[model samples]
Target chain A: MPVTNRQIRLARRPVGPVRQEDWTLTEEPVTGPADGWFLGRTRYLSLDPAMRGWLDDRPSYLPPVGLGEVMRAGSILEVVESAHPDFRVGEFVSGSFGVQEYALSDGRGTRRIDPAAAPLPTHLGALGTPGMTAYFGLLEVGALNEGETVAVSGAAGAVGSLVGQIAKLKGCRVIGIAGGPAKCAWLTEELGFDAAVDYQTEDVRKALRTHAPDGIDVYFDNVGGTVLDAALTRLAVHARVVICGAISQYNNEHTVQGPANYLSLLVRRARMQGFVVFDYVTRYPEAAREIAGWIADGRLSTREHLVKGGVDAFPETFQMLFRGANTGKLILDLT
Target chain B: MPVTNRQIRLARRPVGPVRQEDWTLTEEPVTGPADGWFLGRTRYLSLDPAMRGWLDDRPSYLPPVGLGEVMRAGSILEVVESAHPDFRVGEFVSGSFGVQEYALSDGRGTRRIDPAAAPLPTHLGALGTPGMTAYFGLLEVGALNEGETVAVSGAAGAVGSLVGQIAKLKGCRVIGIAGGPAKCAWLTEELGFDAAVDYQTEDVRKALRTHAPDGIDVYFDNVGGTVLDAALTRLAVHARVVICGAISQYNNEHTVQGPANYLSLLVRRARMQGFVVFDYVTRYPEAAREIAGWIADGRLSTREHLVKGGVDAFPETFQMLFRGANTGKLILDLT
Candidate 1:
């Protein structure tokens, strides 16, 4: 008997916050792998804030997911069957496998990951795109220096959590801004962040002044809007503002609220730059090796909020990011 | 008989646009220069848009003009008497003389200017702060390359006119955005700007698309607001946005309007930076010599709207900058 493959596809472009009706879950019969092709059974799907940008039909760094097409996603999968020379059966691999139970690939962007080295979901979090985004966004784009004060928004999220740790490892003072006391405590106590601001209960600008008294030298902005505005006000002279992501404004039905205090860049003689992590793909191996070393020494910690559900759970699982409900990397475990 | 110094003093901080009540015209008997001081009779007072910023009680690159104090201004003056060793009587000089008929200086931050080298008004227009702003802003901050496309707002103003002309000299395609058909025509026909967008009549974003089809490589922003938003959208990959001034937002009683499409920086892998001309004070002579060479060879042209009025006319003359009534440098000639 042929296997049944369950998949989630985009039904329509989302107006604001993604609704369940915007996606359709369907199942199809799977066939055996053809020549030069390998069949993979999806194990975990990476749910990212950036994924929200992919659903819109606007021109961006990457093309938007087409209506009625399988929702684009990054996933770690087990190669159950293969006719390809490189990929063998029963080996775990990571690639853009979409929101599906089974996928066929010729191994273009696919990379083999050792489950012994790190957990399968870890490949979708700290060792994956989130890791890459945090690494390059802080070290390269933010141009962080030792002894400098670094501030990162979305402090409890995957990218922001890693950013604070990396900045700390580089001998810098780190301040993390998150939604609540629990998430903020997790950053300062568990992740070893120098300070954490509970943006929900505290005034961000006042908190930043108290925490980073000398002003922030590097601000890795993951959440743009009023947080970005508060960060702008506290910039040290010649500070660098790295535009990693703007998760705060991603699902806006109207226009994105810009940083009204951006003129602070002028008064401070600073710079605000933006970049895509894929632009540094060729250097990913170099960064990954360094990050893995830190993790091995127990200096760097990794966390993931794993939701045990099939591909059909993508919509609800994905909404956790915007709601700030997840502590770290949010992943759907489809095992 | 002692000279009576006519002066304009700040009466109160302005809320929105500057009103007549914000200033007080007064006269005081000027005393002879003391040891290490020089006395100067103000000739031409520079009316700049940046002056608006100094009137507000906010922390900026420069301190706000204090109430009951002489209005801070840049001016051309004739040294009438000198007790300082370096400055001599009967010579012309330029310095911060304020909006007054006579000023006393300690010779610090003062530069002697030969009337034969350039006209007295030209010293304030192109060889002064405005010229320094355009040179460093376009070449250093903007990091302009040959054959690249450059777009400048306030294209007919003191700094914008020079930026467009300099880019043209560097083998780049230049587009100027200014209000009114006359200013737009002057930019293209006289200043050699490749194209001109009449922002008053045309949609700035649509006009930029038509003029800069390949997108702008360097956007020298002088007038921020919607114009900055328009320029932000039309930036090329790796474009540089030099934030020199935001004249449009200077008079706002409320908050400034930020570039709503600022995320384009990420999509295009671009950067937006701000700088103060005073930061490059040491290199001013080197840039001045190069710009003077361009002027001598007819490659650069300087224009000044000379208003022949005494120091009392300063309040009305300064308002012309906000109204966009001046074609080039607006100078109140008190000679």
Candidate 2:
């Protein structure tokens, strides 16, 4: 362990697209764990679209990261020292440990993760928050069933990629809407999606008509804005729209453009619900067990784009998420 | 019966606020009932906000009325002749009998309505589509519970007035938002709402803060422009928004302005749903019985604005709904 811990802190609330100036990379002396607490070194950091929401000074599922505080994030950390009874040295754990070299947890939200069960980075992808979000958002919030026609926006990204695979595993006719032909190819060819809409080259509304000839039964919406509006226009009766994240509107300098065609909900007797993964914390183990089984059975696949960098790489790596630069799970390898 | 039946037909689809030119009143020779059909004398016509959506040549739960077709509407009628086995002469029936003096029904959507149970016009208000919309939209879609804080937009209008009352009846704290002082007064004083917000006089956000300090648990949205956006901002965690209608955007010459702060759904883990009352047709009797009982016990009160004129009055009376000119259920008394 180093004598000093490098940390990224929020300098100010971002108005629109995040800039390097919005964050301050600072170094502090590493401290020992207090009673009932444990210290861990962050090995890998999960870069998520939801991180953008936390940068805004607004009321959300979680409070905004306070100015000058360590930027809130989720990561896989290896416990180095512990004064707590439950935690031991060399055990890997996952929690909202923020962007820093050293993380201190009193075991409040921390859970021990195993490297042998799956790769350590996989815990941050399919077996982690992204996986759980896809699980509950589709099966619980979305009420998706077998043979239902599902359309997923941002289908090449972390949560969306997992969502499509899981929906496919559940026997759904999956149509993925993603930018670029390469990402679209991966969704249909590799992920077993029934069809793929290349939102970059094709008209999404017309493509949806061609692909999902029957109206969409479940729409896992990750990208809101025009894509969401187009999906709204093609909902089947009693459609369930899972509002997981709105990556498309997260960096807007102006007001978030809402779906103008939302009245279609009335026409179709449909519902749109938003959910946070933390609410299903108690059931995470159950979902992970099932998802791991699928992975072992060769029915599910997750890809991670690991960028080798120090703490300063956080800003640029996060920007890749909005620009569609990363194909799958975008992670910062801090080690 | 009359030798000539006076009828109002659609001339053209209105681009904005409906004009008289969009309608053409015509006279047709009266004809006797055909086999499996009934001839009825139209008594009361229910004018609704949904009438505007029907004017648009778009796909909805029901098909749009073709140009030159008699304006489609729901009304109470006295069956004068019946070749159908189910419907008998002198029976009061409720169905989608168009805007005409006499109507011929194949007894498809028609149901016998008892005058002894409730007054005839009440059938079009509390026991009608508006009441079913309020009941199911609040309880089922909004998932409202006792002691929950409910904020209803257009609270003095047909569906909204009933929504506020039903929420109160179910032991909720109800806050109503309406355009004028008179309607606001009726919401609080006469309708037994805990509080009222006059959208015309005060800032809606401030009023919502004052009335629903804990935040609105359920928002029964009727008017869907800025009012819907305001309600979206003030929702409590896990709040439910029932989208019954959007009278505010019905006459817009442009696109319907969706709730700009809809991302609040994700922030609060909330839900917004839209439903048409006709979907609950099979359960109508069960809901009507309960609502009627509440009316008899003085737990529910309804006010009707009756306009007496020929079928030519249909266009102006329909416009009154959009103008918020009527306090409660707006009806056309063609008798």
Residue clash pairs of candidate 2 = none
Tens digits of per-residue lDDT, candidate 1, B191-299, equal: 9999999989999999999999999999999988999999999999999999999999999999999888889999889999999899999998998899888988988
What is candidate 1's DockQ?
Answer: 0.84
State the TM-score, rounded to 2 decimals, of chain A in model 2: 0.98
Can you write out model 2's per-residue Cα lDDT over A154-209, one digit (the tens) per residue?
99999999999999889899999999989999998899999999888889999899
Lowest summed lDDT across 10 adjacent residues in model 1 chain B is found at B110-119
lDDT (0-100) at residue B139 of candidate 2?
A: 89
Candidate 1 docking class = high
Model 1 stretches with alpha carbons more than 4 Å out: none
**TM-score of predicted model 1?**
0.99
User: Which candidate achieves the best lDDT against the true structure?
Assistant: 1
**Can you write out model 2's per-residue Cα lDDT over B183-279, one digit (the tens) per residue?**
9888888999999999888899888998899999999999998889988999999999899889889988889897889888887899999998888
